[model samples]
Target: MESSDTTVVRASQPPPVQHEFALRFTSTPRGARLARRLVSHRLDEWGYGYESPVNESLTLIAAELAANAVQHGQVPGRDFRLRLTATSGILRIEVTDTLTERVPPQSVPEVPGDAESGRGLLLVDRLATRWGTCPRSAGPGKTVWAELTDAAAW
Candidate 1:
């Protein structure tokens, strides 16, 4: 959704518009699904889609990030926030949950030889230009963010 807040520019020039979308969802499997769906829609709106390799890569990244927030950062009665920010040359995705101390493992977890789980962050790490976690600016939780640059945006 569009934000009402605006940034002022020179009187002679219109303000630069930034594309952004933010939403909070329950820390559940359903929430993660919705987050991924919305991101895919937004990506398509921004002209990245089935034919664009960037679309497939970033869509998977968003899904993995959202899933991590639900699986590792879920707290009773707490919801997670997924925010999307995009410009011509960059796109950033951030997922925040009420879990200040539950940072992602320092390195991607290695799955056992026969295990059926543990690859989300591995995919994120490989696909994103950069990804990391930081304490939320004004809350008890932390935010995990990843960015994809111009080279990956096309």
Candidate 2:
């Protein structure tokens, strides 16, 4: 008599998944606040908890970039765009505005000790694995982007 046997094998790596969220908001302080809240909500939907470090960091980055867009990049009758994309163990957050003349400084600037503002990008630089500004792909504006790489967060 002959015996039957079965062999099982599993994939060494899981398939790559990509997630994206994009929206345009009025260039106002209220809009900026909404952008930050939505980013946290979307990240929660994508598997990161509200209290997770990844969620908190990305939410803060979104708030800062959105605030900058409203304060410095706002244009009359124009809106700003917020985009979030996660793929291949990386998460990218981008804020695009209609104002093109103003661009973010290449390096973080020193803030006066008594200044009431101007520390957003500094916080972004510290939290993001990578961050920068680039001309908007299809419009007259700039897109400030920051990326976080934490495999466990995905």
Candidate 3:
């Protein structure tokens, strides 16, 4: 049987050069893990696989943002949403959680060498072309987003 993680896009006519997909998953560590894996799988299916640097960078960004949502923004019984959109040469990622009050700190603190936590956003800042947060259009909560420009011709 085909796994729920796999989504196949078929074009009745000519396929557009751009595509998008969005999903919502439970706000938990397991869900966060699935989000990252699904992103890699989808990118592969989209012809990026793991060979492209852009796809690799996107995977990393998705991992960190999803982890942050599960760790910092999770609210009991609520789910987080992952949105991926590719247009022209840009890929945009959006992860939204239920807890709007616990938004991630804009600037990561400079911790000592022995510090073990607090580097997720730092990694995101370094990898994503651009990223930020905004209030959810539906209601409460906020959406954290990042964009990656395709390294190859699209």
Candidate 4:
């Protein structure tokens, strides 16, 4: 009887998949609050629950950006916009408002330790992997964006 040898080979597993989401809202205090809540809810739906660091970070980011848009970028009769997108490794947050002429200060000025204002972007800078602002394509508005790396696992 002839001896027979068999070789077994397995296919490589595919990489983990990623997803994206986006939203828009008005430029108002209520709108900002809604944006923050929606971000947390959406993260929960995406499997990053309230307890996840990613969800927490995203909530903070949404709150700060949306607040800035409403407080600094608001234009009468125009609405702001909030957008969130997530992939396997990255999550991006964007807030757009109607005041193109009034841009966020390039660097937040140093404030007295007890001052209650001027800390929103500072928090964003410290937490986001990358963040910046750009003029909107539709005209007369600006979009501020931040990205979080390792969003799925974080």
Candidate 5:
């Protein structure tokens, strides 16, 4: 029997997650290396082993971003920050540096005929599902970020 009934369906939303790891390091070679190693250790603790492709790619991504922060975004007397976030099988890595300019390139840049470098972002682009840059949320700087799924595309 079809009576006058208007059934209202309410969609459910999952509870918010606050899983995040963050750190600050000086804009130096050692600092970039530390960021990379820490990312590997943290991902392993989070259930992704050292040999896991997801961990490998994420660590590389972190290294590249941190290196960029030190090489291109470095500002005198300013430090860089690394933030790792994991939620629902997604891992996000962000490296923020004191320079507001010098956004990370979306596509690979054309290298000179005799150049031996300038390919870090190309690696990041290929490994990450998505990557981009943004102004630092709490400082006068910029943050370059990349996201990877549990099954990373790398």
Candidate 6:
């Protein structure tokens, strides 16, 4: 009998999967509210349930950032943009507005016990794995971004 040789060939790995959602909203409170709602909806569609901690956290973060954009970054005739991207085990949320003058603090600020506001960024810092701000790539504004990592999403 002739000797037989065995060989193995490995398959190439497929590209990583990614999901993205982007939209522009008017620089108004109503628009901010809508941004929060749509963020939750999109995450749910991406397999993160409405009640999932990841989804809830992201929704809340979106609300905070959107509210900030509306209240602080509003430009008379310009709209704000919201973008959500999920890739591998990370989810990134970005809110861009047309007012570059206002930038979020680098560190969490202490809020007075009786303060009615100024707690949004604190909540975002707590809920998000990491967060920061940057100038918008294609416009005259800043983009506040937050990221959360959940292995379950992988």
How would you encode candidate 5's per-residue C-alpha lDDT over 96-125 as one tens digit per residue? 998987777667776677878887898898
lDDT by residue for model 6 over 1-154, one digit each (tens)?
Answer: 8999998888968446599999999999999999999999999999999999999999999999999999999999999999999877889999999898999999998899999999999999999999999999997999999999873753
Score every model by TM-score.
Answer: 0.82, 0.87, 0.84, 0.83, 0.84, 0.87
Candidate lDDT scores, in order, read 0.84, 0.93, 0.85, 0.85, 0.88, 0.94
Lowest summed-lDDT stretch of 10 residues in model 3?
Answer: 10-19
Per residue, candidate 4 scores C-alpha lDDT tens digits across 36-90 of: 9989998899888998888998899989999999899888888888888775688
Q: Choose 1 or 3, whichever is better by lDDT.
A: 3
lDDT of 1: 0.84
Candidate number that wins on TM-score, 1 or 4: 4
Writing each residue's lDDT as its tens digit, candidate 1 over 6-125 gives 887866753353688899998999999999988888878877775577777777888998898999988999999998887657788999898887888767877777877788888899
> Which residue ranges in model 3 land beyond 4 Å of their true spot?
1-17
Error of 4 at 51 (Å): 1.2
Distance from true position, residue 129, model 5, in Å?
0.3
**Candidate 4, 148: how far from true, in Å?**
0.4
RMSDs, each prediction? 9.5, 7.3, 12.7, 7.5, 3.2, 5.8
Flag regions of model 5 displaced more than 4 Å.
1-15, 110-114, 152-154
In candidate 6, stretches whose alpha carbon ends up further than 4 angstroms from where it belongs are: 1-17, 151-154
Q: Rank the candidates by TM-score, best first.
A: 6, 2, 5, 3, 4, 1
lDDT of 3 by residue, 54-148 (tens): 77888899999999999999889999999987776788889999888987677766667788988788888888888999998887899999988
How high a TM-score does candidate 6 get?
Answer: 0.87
Task: Please state the error at residue 33 of candidate 6 in Å.
Answer: 0.5
* lDDT of model number 4: 0.85
Model 1 spans > 4 angstroms off: 1-17, 151-153
Pairs in clash, predicted candidate 5: none
